[model samples]
Target chain A: MKQDIREILAKLGGLPVSVDTISDSADLYTAGLSSFASVQLMLGLEDKFDIEIPDHLLNRRSFASIDAIAETVSAVRAGQEAA
Target chain B: MDMQISLLDRLFDSGLLIDTGVEGVYARSGTFEDVITAFEGLIDRFAGNTGAEVIRFPPGMNRAHFEGSGYMKNFPQLAGTVHSFCGCELDHQNLIKCMAEGSDWTEGQKASDIVLTPAACYPLYPIVARRGPLASGGALFNIQSYCFRHEPSNDPARMQLFRMREFVRLGRPEDVMAFRGEWMEKGKELMGSLEMPVEVDVANDPFFGRAGRLLKNNQRDQNLKFELLIPINSVANPTACMSFNYHQDHFGSTWGLKTADGETAHTACVGFGLERIALALFHHHGLDPKLWPASVRKALGH
Candidate 1:
């Protein structure tokens, strides 16, 4: 949700990048995020937060940017806690 | 089964499958006739040996047919309707008045809506429902269905008018799966015998939009569908030669189809793209049917 995080994610291209440059609201597609790269990003986020993404959540909206992606992750986590 | 039956004897000589060109809608170009003939022969031989009776359904289904079947709930985008203006009258005066009122009408007319059959199986359900349940065990229907879709892509593989040569088998859950599995194997075997290269893998229907994407993934995970893919021109993205699907009690429940013990019937179907297959063979091999390799020609009943 931080502006710095959005800037970092926006610059994160198709290739793996240092965590320092990652942002929360980056435009993944405009930032050169390929389909394969999105999968890679999913894996990285799973490792970072220890949250497993269900297969159904694999889509454009889930990978649009760091802020959107974080919102989904938070929602999933909150749902898990409530359950 | 390997009786070396004459091509004509197997099909066209009281052949089970028929060749139809609904206003050139379903016909192929530069090789459609020969392809239709070949598919007719192929399906006739296959269906005849497998105990299926050929049935060519009407051009379209009725409006209530889909409404009763919950088609509008499941797939409204693919549904099409028959429309006509019986009588009407309109003029510039009417147009001007409508424009001023922010309403427009060309004429006043009587219109009734009729649903065009989405898939070949839509109409079959009603017919079978009226039959008062299939005999004790199971039944297989041989259908060469003409179907239409709105978003017919220019990709020759996707056509507005295409023939879905379907083998609809209904019975218990196990029976439906077995039928689909058996035909999946048979399709591969047939393709192999014809010397055509093919691959069998999990397949999907052209479900529409966002929700459809989720449904398609669910279909894959449930193993409800499989496809026989053959390289039509490019080896990278192959055309789906055939699809074997098991609909577990979906249609049966909708139509109230039941077995002897009173449980809903399980249904499965294997679809062959007759014209698409023809295009593949013609594109790969040439237009001359006689010149095709012996095994290939015989497989297609050339």
Candidate 2:
């Protein structure tokens, strides 16, 4: 999941540095992810994971880092399965 | 709500505002115009020496540029586009007939190539970008325009059509931040000179929809916007008379704006809500400018 997240970030994040250069807990915003790019990243993640991120999870924390994003995707998938 | 309606009624009754039978739209009387003019002069006295280029644009801007600005993507609810009845004589006849029948005559109106200017600075970026790279010292501009929004309300401060006076800076991120910081202080001082109580607080634009929630949160978390608030119609929710925004490379990337060194330029703008400021003066002082405090009068050259 983390590798897939890094690949998506590389394509859509518009960061100045490589995604692999940053750790899973590294702040994406600090790594040059812009508000506009973050939106694009969110869309890319949705397409890649085939998961619908709920409105409540659409915040900075959900996309703060790769770890946070993976956790959010897990939670959404869990909710989907339970339903 | 009573106070809001009463204030609107009083302005209409006192001839300060002429009723046009439409909510959030009114004609300003000579007295009201005078106050706005004086306040503008005061602003000039403060920023005139900054050597900023002065530009004025009509209330409508090119529709293509408006689309490029991405305003619709964020605040689609507040945007207003200009439309016209562009059809043959047969269609015109039908339009007239529809209007005569008290039906939706505007349904046939086609979207024009122009949209109402959302803010004073919206039209500046493209013009600046067309001029090539910025100078080493960057660029500063003084602009004022009649802005439009779709929100209609009884609060005099929240007009559907109003004037916004803005000073925009384009350059490095540090310089842009400094410009906003300087104006934040200058804004408070300018308001203080009029003896009006004020507060500065972080703010975010009313972005639209569920995706907008993320944008709003990101903006607030980064402290990208601030507003100088003064009580006007309601004390509980003071009106934002002035705003300072730091668009770090957003406009630069969108407009292809570049610095002398070929780097993406950061942009910042400080905007003063002219009508809202006038309303605040009237709310704090007496409606009659002649009865305002001596210091306030002197500051505005009233």
| Per-residue lDDT of candidate 1, residues B52-139 (tens digit) | 7678876577778778987765477776677555542545566567778888454443335566667777778778878887877688
Q: Which stretches of candidate 2 lie over 4 Å from their true place?
A: A3-22, A43-57, A75-83
Instruction: Give interface RMSD, per candidate.
Output: 8.8, 1.3
Error of 2 at B282 (Å): 0.5
Candidate 2 chain B weakest ten by summed lDDT: B208-217
DockQ winner among the candidates?
A: 2
- The stretch of ten residues in a row with the least summed lDDT in candidate 1 chain B is B1-10
- Sorted into a CAPRI-style docking class, model 1 comes out as incorrect
The residue pairs in collision within model 2 are: none
Native-referenced DockQ of model 2 = 0.62
